[model samples]
Target: MVRITDEQIEQWRRDGYVLIPNFLSKEETEAARNGVFEWFSPSWDDYVAAGRKIDKPGVLAFPWDNSGLNKAVLHDDLIDVAERILGTKDIHLRLVRLDEAHLGIKYAGNPSNNSLPDVFHQDWGNNTIGPHHPEDFCSPAFFYCLDDVKPGMAPVQMVKNGLEPNPKNAEKFICPGGSLCIYSTWTWHASSEFEAKEGHRPTMWLGFNRNDRMWEGGRFFTIKATGTRDGWLRAIGEATPRQRELLFLPAVDDEKWTDEMIDGMFKRYGKHGFDPEPYRQAKAKREAQTNGKH
Candidate 1:
């Protein structure tokens, strides 16, 4: 059901990126859109008074409090696509960011209405400290448009097989809300200019790579953030065990899941109704298998 076709996989191989139009249904798209606005615009009156300017675009790295975004971040389809391309089920989360681009603002230095953070560049150039070949399985990234992205609304600009920024070869990604753009960190891309007179562009970027190469990618938030940010704790409590594994938590049957460790997990996350039964069951199953072998 929620699987990508072989054609899509080939596209990624040939072009280093693929755009899945309407990856999310209207309801799901609206939910994510609502979350963006609710989190960004708490007070509409003041937001409107400020000329709909949100001061600056807001970014929530690994945000767990927003139910809509959390669902999309851990959506089954997202993982399905990642696993298919990475050729491994052992992938982990690299970046879970909710990014916003407000309109009607002038860029500081570049006077060119370009709303993106920087000029065209390969993500791997900054994502890694060393070199990487295009053939290597680098971090795969996603840009989920939370709202309709029309031309001149700062849609994503990418160059096919481009090693550097070449405006002549660059192509603009103009798609409706709920659309998803999947590309590798090795792909060359940048943000287009935001020239819309009235409107905003809200998008989310999710990135992941192989579990063994944890040092290769970056994320804004870390596990320790849970202590200070309630959203992190909430995410821990609410996430499914499979989803937790993506966060690099131990598997249900991991050797680390001793009674003490399980108890610690409960102590840390029981407040948000975290279920420990699965861990307990895994332990019992392992014990049963051991006794049977003996």
Candidate 2:
């Protein structure tokens, strides 16, 4: 299991994203690599980029789903990391896409790659959910690199504190093999264009969104993508500190939060729109179910 420290947690709260190296072991990484191809596919490259589909999917794409791609969707390590980061019991696995562009495919976002619209926009446009855009309330995502990415051969460019403003100019994340990038919904990031400096770039994008209808993290896979890693990432979530307080999680109840509890926290800290009475009762019931209540 991976260990997290106060520094890492603080970094996430402050920076909107954290870099974790070797998130998966060589064995696990290999297992994921083999898992995708274990099924069926014609080429080492994705069926899409091989001129299979036009009007291509930019950086986001995938294959398989809850009803399709079998167990790779339940990768063990991915689940553990999600649990620590999301702090909720329910995690809805989103799309799994491997991005590795070749010379042939059609670019979709902005025809003129030089003036592409792939600038900066939070997945939740204006932080609202409706008919226009679907993805809402998606908290975090796991970007795993299956191979060694040497700069130009397709690296991910992320802003430093994107929840606010990214002073860094397209920071290229050069994480070696067996590492994963953990990013919250607030961070603004982009997948760099794939250029084979030495070896072919192979990366997997596994996203998890909250299971709320208001959140469309589970958006549909609708276009042609680049190379396919043929691997999978999994996710599991544990109740967060906020969730525990809202649900009165007995499992974590013993922790000293009394200081906040005495300060009119019921009105101050809970969801802004809900009533405190129902929340407390619901919290009590949920706490009784979880053990170690606060």
Candidate 3:
């Protein structure tokens, strides 16, 4: 059973993420690859037509497979860890996709690689839905590598302590397999265009939250999350009623807000001390501009 050490757990809370080594077994890693093949191989026939994402070479900028896919969430292998981090047994996944980052003489995609690679920016651009009130996060993202990674292959880089109590020290860390990376909806990150640097082709995922108090991510215990041979638990499972509300993470009404709204917010927050002043200021300014146009 893989119990998340207090150190790893606390690192995630304080640093916005953490790194754990030798997290998955070879057999388990192979399973994740099989899942991708089953879903993406030309044989699946109409999997995408049914509204399922089909795996393909360039679908992701990295190489990946999903043989070790967790049945609980149907796509997120680390949802149990996510649940533990959120401190909620009941959880809902924002979205899930199996991916692969292939290696070669050079990176995949256009070799011309003329333009810059993925831009270094936070999620959802400026339209982040929350971080201000009890509402949905604009766009938090997560990634799980399906293979053992080398920093030169498909490495994902993030700013250390990128988004918490005020992110500082923009240092970058390489997340390897048996490991997953999560980021706030508003963190700044990036990658190079076939630079031949030390990194791995990593599968990436974008996920939202199903908790009123939402944090990006944490670690998981594979053996304990499910019976070693128990196939019943998949990636992400169903959410409870309370979880459903948190999943909705409703957008606060900017136009309808008042000093009374602020009062209600403080009372509701009580001692939790979760503050969204930054998000609120941003949202209000956007709303004001929109109203002015009308």
Candidate 4:
């Protein structure tokens, strides 16, 4: 598993973002890129034919529909980094977006190749939720590059410190394929114009919030899935226990796990590894604490 260093954490706290190069290996990155292309090829057409707006070339709200993509989100390195940054093991997923920019695409709906404008802004602008504390960590946006994000490949531009738009101080996320860039939700950032001479840009995005803030509608992103609840459940059924935990599936007393859910867990993780005893013990301990039992 990849580990986050103290220096990296300090940088994240200071700059509101941190870029980790080569987070995924070459083989893993290629697999993700291929998987994304295959998944989006058919889904994009289906989504548009179903009367949905084709604002982007290949944008999937919940690309977890692909099993490989689902596993990528629960990557041990990513989970470890998220836990270190959030200072908790109980992290909740807020959203998962797959963006694919095909070659010869232009800004907006126009056919011209003028590239998109740069508009740095925070993501929490419209979210009126709790834990509005500016200093407190609300969410971390993770971006995984499936292609080389060079100078003109619509790389993300971020201000050095905060929202002040200082072009001289801005940093472009120019990294090779498989790199991961993690930024705070409050950070002021924008994507640069896609000036790449050739090839397409594909990226995997994952948003996460600390679990303690779940009371303010903890599972907000769950509703953002593109398909029905049953479809989402079916997709996640292929995930392992650790992956399901990242998806915030009920493991303890929050809700009774259906027989299918249990069977799926066993099928994916096996009986020896798919143990629910820890959750049961934790629930009992919580009850004991409430009853003043040491």
Candidate 5:
């Protein structure tokens, strides 16, 4: 029973983004942070030590390999906001990225020797899938902070209301460890420099898209770059039915929906005080419509 306020919805509609502070408990944030450190830090450190380009493109795929990290991505509050904002229960996880900014890593061949590549741009491009219009809210990126992100800690600078080239109005996402900063994929944003002398800025990037979309740019890149299809399938296999629904795989046909499935749904969602009857009824209607069309 998580809810999004009308004011929050209006803010997103107006600014193309919203920051929900304290969206996760401190315990939840700590668990996710530990999981990332355990699972991703080694490779990330190796990449840095190799003197490879710091601004290497592509994300760390399938961090859900860690069960704790998987749970964070499927956190109820995050899902509720996503579903409400996207205006759909049928959502798909386009990407799960673990991004870290260390104290002294900088882009290669840059004279400034800045510790971050502060490039302001949108996630979508000419080669991206679907319409390029800014009005299309098909994809959204949720950034879950794993550390208290203060200014100069490489907080992401976003142009409020999609306004770019206006430094006076740019909004820096400085918040506590458990905050969730959500923005449309089309919104203009960039990372600030890691001005802190020590420590790391770790954040989990969860990108999602409406299920009806035929193509997802991140999904395409993930499968290609990370060879993660098998791992992803395994992760999904381990998820609960509700979690599987978030993955946006083809739904189980209503004809195949058994008493056991319905009971399981109740057993799971009921604990959260959710009544599943309405969802079940609506699903049945959708099935009826599909069967009729067939």
Candidate 6:
């Protein structure tokens, strides 16, 4: 696990973003790449070995059945850094995805090498559900490179000050595999056209915001979290407490954790291995302390 230094935190404050190289180990990166292939295309290894050219982009939204990607996204170190940037432990998980750069496509849906103006924009529009102003929302996000993103591999470019939306003034995020770039919804960033002749450029993106802000929400097109998706249930069942908390599950010590609620939750999610003992113990402790005090 990598620790975010004071210098990195200061850098984030000054530039609205920070890049940490080698944040994830080589082993971790390989696991993530394998996980992406497992979920996105099980035959990806064979395709790559055969030098097959892909015509379409590869994308998978959050709550998918990819444990490798899930571990990296919900990583303890990643969450700590997010809390530090967002200034709260009570954070909502906004987005998690596998965004790959394909051979003939660009970020904005134009064919690669097409004569089109570079598109640079802030994420606040989609993140905040079209807030009245960009300033009204702030969702800190992480872009983790699962592959070495060199020039022409669809590297993302962002304005240094997070203010300018010009292509000429943006800095490209060219980093090695296992690297991470932390940016916010306020940052102006754009993905470049994929120019690499072959191979894959896999990246994972995760975003979060303060849980208290109801107005600040997720991207509109992502699958609803409350749906009967198998991924949703798997995540809820298998996730750790810290991970579950980001999914809007109240902490064990939260005031809302009553005996009745605990029992209800056990009934609802018990089939998926949802353990209620933590909540049960917490409630018992709270009641015991209250009785003793009275």
Best by lDDT: 1
Off by over 4 Å in 6: 41-59, 96-117, 129-137, 162-164, 219-228, 263-273
List RMSD in Å for every model shown.
4.1, 13.3, 16.7, 6.7, 7.6, 4.7
Write one digit per residue (lDDT tens) for candidate 1, span 4-90.
687987887778788888999899898877776665442234455666455423434555456676777778888888888788888
With a 3 Å backbone cut-off (N, CA, C), the pairs that clash in candidate 5 are none
Cα-based TM-score, every candidate: 0.84, 0.52, 0.48, 0.71, 0.69, 0.79
> After best superposition, candidate 6 residue 279: deviation in angstroms?
2.0
Runs with alpha carbons beyond 4 Å of true place in candidate 4: 41-59, 96-115, 215-224, 227-235, 252-294
In TM-score terms, candidate 4 sits at: 0.71
The stretch of ten residues in a row with the least summed lDDT in candidate 2 is 97-106
lDDT of 2 by residue, 11-108 (tens): 76676677778766677666544433333321234543565432323322333321112222345555655665667645555543222111112122
What digit string (tens of lDDT, one per residue) describes model 6 on residues 120-215? 766666556544554432567778888787787677787867456777887887899899888777777777766666545667777777877755
Q: Give per-residue CA lDDT, model 4, range 173-228, as digits (tens).
A: 88998888788767777767666554455667676667776642223545353533
Candidates 4 and 5 compared by lDDT, better number: 5
* Error of model 1, residue 36, in angstroms: 1.8
lDDT of each: 0.69, 0.45, 0.41, 0.60, 0.61, 0.66
- Superior candidate under lDDT, 1 versus 3: 1
Top of the candidates by TM-score: 1
- On a 0 to 1 TM-score scale, where does candidate 6 land against the true structure? 0.79
RMSD of 4: 6.7
Ranking by TM-score: 1, 6, 4, 5, 2, 3
* Candidates ranked, most accurate by lDDT first: 1, 6, 5, 4, 2, 3
